[model samples]
Target chain A: MKEKLTDSELIAMVNGGNQQAFSELMKRYRKMVARVVIGMLGDTPEADDVGQEVFVRFYQSISSFRGDSALGTYLTRIAINLSLNELNSRKRRFLFFSVKDDEQPLPDLADEANVDESLSRNELIEKALAHLDPKFRSVILLRLIEGYSTKETAEMLGVPLGTVLSRLTRAQDRLKEIVSKLSREMVINTADTTAKVKVKTELK
Target chain B: MKSKTFNPEKNIGNFFENYDADFKPFFETRVMARIENMVMSYQMNRDFAFRKIFMPALATLVVVFVLAVIMGQGISVQSLMGWTNIDMESAIASSMGY
Candidate 1:
């Protein structure tokens, strides 16, 4: 029965202190929130926490949710803001610790021979995304990945439309470079492994 | 040069359209749990604030009001500041030697 209710209806129920209604709303929008949060922060535990936080914040402010925009868009705006805050704190931690950028370990590359292909592809996507500045990443995720228009992206990020457009261009260029670099590295790693196998076979 | 063919714009769009980020099982349950915890803590904090800070503050204000009324001063800025006996016009005139 709750599934048939609209977002505004569920919001009204939630405002009336219906926790079940809020749960229904969460079930409705969890994927949208997950896309934004996971796109920005990658698929980490922190991303999960941030995803929960987006809905929690919405529930807290449900009374004031005037339905000025779509519920998905409002939750998305919160997700982006919280993700950016997480990124800022990550930057601060990196700076305070003076950690070398390269010293940051890759996601489980030690068993490259046994790694699954699709998993590696997703990892590659994430690594390339990590190279982008948060500003550019937000644009890429919103504009390209999540398929929001330039105007919507700008509004979500609280930037000018021109800024979103420019950032989208630069982010695409950077991602292309990073993806190409990663592909080359993958090819080289394969070649090195093949050469090692060949040398061992010949020696045997 | 191979990177030129790897258009991130088209590829990432296609990839992410099908990409379900590792959404954990029981996501709604976990989110609801967190919300419940948050609501619980918020109510606890509010109750604590009312008891610890607000109640004492209200009591002090009431005491001050009662004392003021008992002393025949009522409530005014001067009376609150214990400045009830000063005549400002004459005091200023005398200070200025008028």
Candidate 2:
């Protein structure tokens, strides 16, 4: 069965121009790729597009893949690179338009049936992540969220191990600060809503 | 009141572990479709290049080579650069005061 094929087998089939094999490969690694992309870029449409581009790039270079690294690692590398590129362009756009970072809209969560506690928490997490510098963000996502080893994260990012360690320390410190601030704002917002509701009920 | 401790590391790990990072429904189908479109476009561009650019350029090269050979000039840097009439041996000898 195609599902039982190893990465090397799938890669060989793909190199032989088997589209179905490539599709199977994509299906197999989509979650891993999605996690890296979405973690780095947030759950924006650009993340989705980058997710697709990762596989497309692999397909284009199938003939030369050589299978030195596992397919998952290779795809994660592409996702990270593409996500960083998206982040750079986002920085450029923000600077060019002189847009206040806070004015940027929250990621859409309307499709969910219940946009309650979990939704807000996720939104807070995303906001906190968005505040990180891309370099720090990448290390946090890979080392913490995706649960890759620090050395693995460094290899994937093409950075030295010491750099990853230093970045991880700094990134964690910055993330704690950002998350604390966001959590405080969330608490204030909830209290404000409760007070407004109490007043409205009393007026009625 | 018991104060709650904030641990970003544990919170981040827990949050992302439960996070559904899956793409929308039929994402694989969409990706496959895009790959097909890309492959088709690449093949089309390659074909177009072979037809419009490569073939004509190759034909021109062959024609020029044939013309050069037929005219007995051969295909050398001198002949191609319009220096076919120069007598390099005698010119070099005279320059050296032979």
Candidate 3:
């Protein structure tokens, strides 16, 4: 009967200092939170830390949680905000070290050294997404990875629907650009290596 | 169909084609461990606030009372606040057990 209790009931128990109730809430939303966190933070230890923080934050403030949205959406919102906060803090720390503070931070993805033919399609997309600006990346994460409807995505980000659409277009364009660029370079390198191998074979 | 060209970018979606991260075993247990740690830390903070902050504050209030009693000029907690003296004559007449 306790397992069958609804989200409201679970939250009430959590408010009463029930640790198991909190754990149940975590179990219910863990994967969705992980998907959003890991999609932003990558498959690193940082992602796991952020994922855990999201539930902890929700548990701490469970009393203020008036169920205006589905519990999943509420948790997802926290996950997204925390991920962006982590990013902004990283940028601030970088700014503190850099000499030219006047320059606007350009949106660049991660180190593409991980970009190679051996990577699977999923790994490639994940890697490519790392290069995208956080705004555009959120669009891809929410739209492509999490599969939220356009309206829902817009609501979550507090942006207009048109904004979400435009961001999606930009994100897809960037993704295509990065993927195509890497794919081309890899293809060319493979061709060049093959050509050298063939000439060596001829000499032999 | 005139043989569609192989554009690597076009097949980008195919990379995630049939791709999803499988659920790792004991994922819930791992998450719960983190939550439990957070809860314990929060409790410790509350405990610290009571011991480190509340106890000292209570001690200061007790010291204020002892200092006021030693001075004995009707040295109530209110006197330290620089409040205007109460009109005791008006107070006694108003409280005539009516």
Q: Rate the local accuracy (lDDT) of all candidates.
A: 0.78, 0.75, 0.72
Candidate 3 residue lDDT tens string, A73-110: 89989999998888787678887686442222332324
User: In DockQ, how does model 3 score against the reference complex?
Assistant: 0.22
Please give the distance, in angstroms, between residue A41's alpha carbon in candidate 3 and its true position after superposition.
Answer: 2.1
lDDT string for model 3 (B1-89, tens) is 01113264665445444434423566667767877787689899999999999999999877777776777745755755536566988
In model 2, the clashing pairs are none
Docking class of 1: acceptable
| Ordered list by lDDT, greatest first | 1, 2, 3
Give the DockQ-based CAPRI class for model 3: incorrect
Task: Enumerate the candidates' DockQ scores in order.
Answer: 0.26, 0.31, 0.22
Task: Compute the lDDT of residue A79 as modeled in candidate 3.
Answer: 90
> Candidate 2's residue-wise lDDT over A1-204, tens digit each?
544999899888878878788878888899888877877788889988999899888888888888888787888888999999988787778876755442343323332232233235555666667777788888988887777898899999999999999988887777776666555555555566688789999999
- The worst-scoring run of ten residues by lDDT in candidate 2 chain A lies at A110-119
- Evaluation by DockQ, superior candidate among 2 and 3: 2
True contacts kept of 1: 0.40
